[model samples]
Target chain A: MQSNQELEGFRVELRDWLEANCPAEMRGGEASESSICWGGKNFEFASDAQRDWMERAASKGYTVPTWPVEYGGAGLNRAQEKIFKEEMDRIGARSPLDSFGIWMLGPALLHFGSHEQKLHYLPPIARGEIRWCQGYSEPGAGSDLASVQTKGEDKGDHWLVNGQKIWTSYADKADWIFALIRTDREAPKHKGISFLLINMEDAGVETRPIKLISGASVFCETFFTDVKVPKHQIVGTENRGWDVAKYLLTHEREMISGGGQGLSGGRALGAVLNESLGEGQEMETTLRADAMRCEVDALATGLTLERYKDQAEAGTGAGDASAMLKYMGTELNKQRHELLMAAGGSDALEWDGPLGNRPADWLRTKANSIEGGTSEVMLSIVSRRVLGLGA
Target chain B: MANLVMTEDETMLADAARGFLDKSAPVKAFRDLRDAGKTHDAKMWKEMADMGWAGVLVPESAGGSDMGHAAAGVLAHEMGKTLVVSPFLSTAVIAATALRNVSDARAEKALAAIATGDVTYALAVDETSKFNPEATSMVATREGNGFRLSGKKTFVVDGALADRLLVLAKTDDGLTLFDIPADRAGITRNAQNMIDARDSARIDFDNVEATGEDVLGQVDSAMSVLKPAIEAGQAALAAEMAGLSAGAFGMTVAYLKERKQFGTVIGNFQALQHRAAHLWCEIEVTASAIVNAGRLLDEDPDNAIMAVSLAKARATSTAQLAVQEGVQMHGGIGMTDAYDIGFYMKRARVGAEWLGDYGYHANQVAKHRGF
Candidate 1:
């Protein structure tokens, strides 16, 4: 509700606050695959300080700026939120919260959560008190996402959840999970699904870490043995969970696509390539052209993201168009990483410290085209929805 | 700044062009034109002109859409989709842009007529295979009241069919541009058949007469005018290349999905899927670059020159890769003359080599960066 002048004034004040509070040691530091953190998860050194900062910012609704002020968000317009991000990025200020709750569940809840549900959940998420993980992709269902067989049986007062989810990122570390379960056995595949929110600490919940090619155990296989979730935790109408899942997938794709842009604090692709390739490697004329081409694409994709963000703020964001952006962005990011790995050559294959880590990181990026939705699935969406090709 | 982003109006125009080309300019038409050794489809050209495509980039004051380069590029992209062979690029975009940029009233009127489908023009710039406009090899000297143009211009695009020719020549002062009528005395045209079956001509000008009025812009500053035109031309060609690459990639994917090999559709193979996915990514990236260049051209003409160079260089490489991979992925069927994939690949090669090859544009970009 603030005027443009008021927003500008707030930006200046926020910039000064960030400059004073952000730790100098945290600035310009390399991000590890394990921890892109200035402080640990326990908030050891500045635990109270970080918590206070988070609480103050959340109280002002700055943590989720575009969310309503009544719902514990800053209620800032898109331009103001952009300025907030710019200032925070400029000062190297780390986010108080970095979890699926902040990125995925919060947006879905805002759209589909009941008033009581929003009141109960939005505050805790905004305050960085809860970490959420996704439970959508099952062992049997990967790219054919709607085929999830996780069952949520009605048990009168509460629903009993029983099934397993694979590729559940941070499931062990998460405080809660938003899952898609089959609620109607006789109905069609997509129509039978339901979206439910469950506590990770519930009696029958379990998680086992899944080690990846990157050697990082970032994801897990989550199991629910008669896990009980309260009836109120179901998002939207029962058996319409597929709709909520689809909506959440859109947000997840947006997050993944946007993730490519802010990696390692807005470093230019050309700078990254030059740094990795070294001074006199004799970049073939063809390779130089390819690099410039990639750079142009990154810039264009970034601009497209900005344009779409503006649309989202205006409440007119195209749902399927986000898929197009995500599809293009993740693939481009993978290509960029591929180029970096190739430029690094044998050095990229080293796996000891940070130098040893590049190869693993590069290997992990191969999931970019597979995760969220397979690149093939994204194209099908584009051809059918955006271009109206297959009808 | 002109809105280089495609608006609804522009998208509608592009869709209309696509529909027309799909229904009218199919693969058979392209083959017929090639077999007949024709440069363009006469009926299809008239239809496109009737749709006001020839004037898509001209100013509204000159009885054209004044839509600008971005819209023109979109139209050309659709044309590239069906491989609609014509002088649309040479007459509508290149020649018209040259005349418009010159800011001469007479030239504007001539361009207006071209937009109305009553006139057509071609650019005679390339003297050799290299992309150096400065080394024109054509000379113009002062004579009584006008000027005499003397030179041999090869690969003059649509030179045989053009009503007017915009000739780049060197004068005593410096390089200049002259608007010479095709019927001028001592102007001889030798029509040449191109590899892709496009129309081109080797023009010989033996003391052709010209006046100051026919000189576009400043007499000695043709390079300035020529530079932007070349960039615009390159950008348009890149857009076309994007379309051609997309179509070819789509056909390959379709073929892969249908063709059974080893008791399964070839598309299901992990290796082929990966390759196809990579090519799709390349096409998307190239498209993003070309679209961005077009948008930048509308916003900043100067920066657009660099963007165009970058785009064309990238597109040339990417298109070649896409077509080669597309054909290889299709196996022997892709190599057959009956298959349309070869046509797309041939068109891509012609488009890539038209303005400058990948190496030339890369060097241009490097030079711009002070390398």
Candidate 2:
């Protein structure tokens, strides 16, 4: 660990570096979902600035700064990583790349995957060369993920996988998937599962985009029919995939909780309200109060995240408290969007044009609680695992 | 005052305060104090003063240990858990904030006296007005070099026992703050019986005399100091409310585990478990808000208002829900006066109303947002 003075110096240098490197266009307001870069085989650049930003960030390993430098990361410690984030936040730098592989699969591979797997898989993720999607929730298993029946039959050197995964976010665009598959049908529900890595382009693999109310198809139903996955593609042991699944779920929840801080890096609610209400808008006192309260809660949620990160760095990792964070974060996100919608008034109801996007984004926040885990499921975990309140 | 992490010193301070309160002034002690017809435990107040809690916000140069509002918040939180009936919030938090915000020789003298447990102070801001601080209608007329104050201040926490009163009054310029001795001539105090049985009074000022030395900060521009000082107080109250809610929630959970019904403990029921889980989440979120408010007070005084209001509003709502559910979950026992859970509900009610209710604070947040 470096001294505080050394870290301070690093921060100054890092701030200057980011300012010099990050394109001016990428340092403005929040980046819309469509503008986000999910590096994959078929990824398209939204703009030159976006492509340039991703290339610059990936070259320096800032996309996955905490990972080992050998795995295309900056290899910064947790404290330095935090400083890096703060500096980026100070300049409102848009995330150069958004990938599940970075948030979920990358961490799992680092912690539980073999050295061979880490070397093979993590660098591509760090470089944003391959985007990944999760294959956790099956049609049969939503909250009861242990009951997943996505089966993978053992065959000498490969596994034949078959089953459908519901709510697979961005599956259509993903290059690969880290999925939970039942390798042993006779074993107990949780014991027979295996975490498998399969290319989305593999034979008999298909994704059907699920159109949402917001008129977006970000979610897809991913199906695997006799899909061949090499034995080495199996993460962890065949019958012990539930462990990897559980670990990955923690990361997934953490990722969803990041939405609590606003996925778009949108302007502050107060700022938005000020613009919408204008100088003489007759905004109701109750509405204003609700907006302010929600804004405060959102800021507090950010602070809470920092506290949990600090605690995690200090060795008291959030553990099941990640459920608490996920629950609070998603709920706060919903509250923020709700207030935004209210501030927009009749204009928020438009279904097209720039003004209509607020309503769409507000509707999008609805998925926050449902995805990762339903708010109810998160609450149950918090009560039983975090608060020790169980029946 | 949102802190992502507490320093080792702060953690130790919080832990020690909690331990002391648990041992010395638990929920049962509140009952004992009431049975003894005492609004506050003077001995405990002195003990807290000895612990340097009274001077937590006072700078070291003013004959006190200079701790940040975050530390004071920790102490306030611990005190709330045990419902430690004292003037600590009024005297230590509000008054100390006023003295610190406006650093004058007279204020420093008062700070010194407060540090040694020799004197106590309360902000007599609320009149027959609404919750707004700017609604103060007390008149302060200039009389030669001095001033004559006359009006009524209602719902002044610990006002009856305070040595000095930070009175908000209307001057020729605008709203002002006057620090006057509580025992000054022509001043009368009457206890107002509250649901929580906490020390509060309605003070009547009948042409009370004050000089230039009595003015805190500027005459009409006291908002510069009073705004942040009152915000600090609000943040402290939010911390206390968070503690009270957590304490109540814990007690309710314990009761659910112990008190069995229909062949097993009722805690086994999914319905109660779900409600308990919801309460736990709410309380945890509110805790985050309180920490944020305290951090803003210590670090970003200029931007502390919104965070303070958020903390107060969230904690107020959370504690209210917890206290109400606490009584309901405990069945018939929770409703009885003999039970400690009932006390939490009463204390939560008073605490919620004292600083500002959820609606009031939330409104302030909205107003700050330019509504």
Winner by TM-score? 2
Candidate 1 docking quality: incorrect, acceptable, medium or high: incorrect
- Candidate 2 lDDT by residue in tens digits, B180-258: 8899999999988878887789999998999988899998887887887788889999999898998999899998888
Chain A only: TM-score per candidate: 0.89, 0.95
DockQ: which candidate is best? 2
Model 1 chain A weakest 10-residue run by lDDT: A36-45
- The residue pairs found clashing in candidate 2 are A391-B268, B1-B292, B1-B293, B1-B294, B1-B295, B1-B296, B2-B292, B2-B295, B2-B296
Top model number, lDDT: 2
Residues B1-371, candidate 1: write the lDDT tens digits.
12223567767988888888888887678988787867766676777778888887778888887777787779878877767787788888887778778776797788788788777788899899766787777889989767899889987878888988989999888899888789999999999867677878999999899998888888888977777777778888898888788788878878877899788877666667656766665665566557667777777887787668767876887789888998998899989988888888888878877888887876665555433
- The 10-residue segment with the lowest total lDDT in model 2 chain B: B1-10
lDDT of 1 at B308: 83
Candidate 1: lDDT of B350?
80
Pairs of residues at least 3 apart in sequence or in different chains that clash in candidate 1: A61-A73, A61-A74, A350-A356, A351-A356, A352-A356
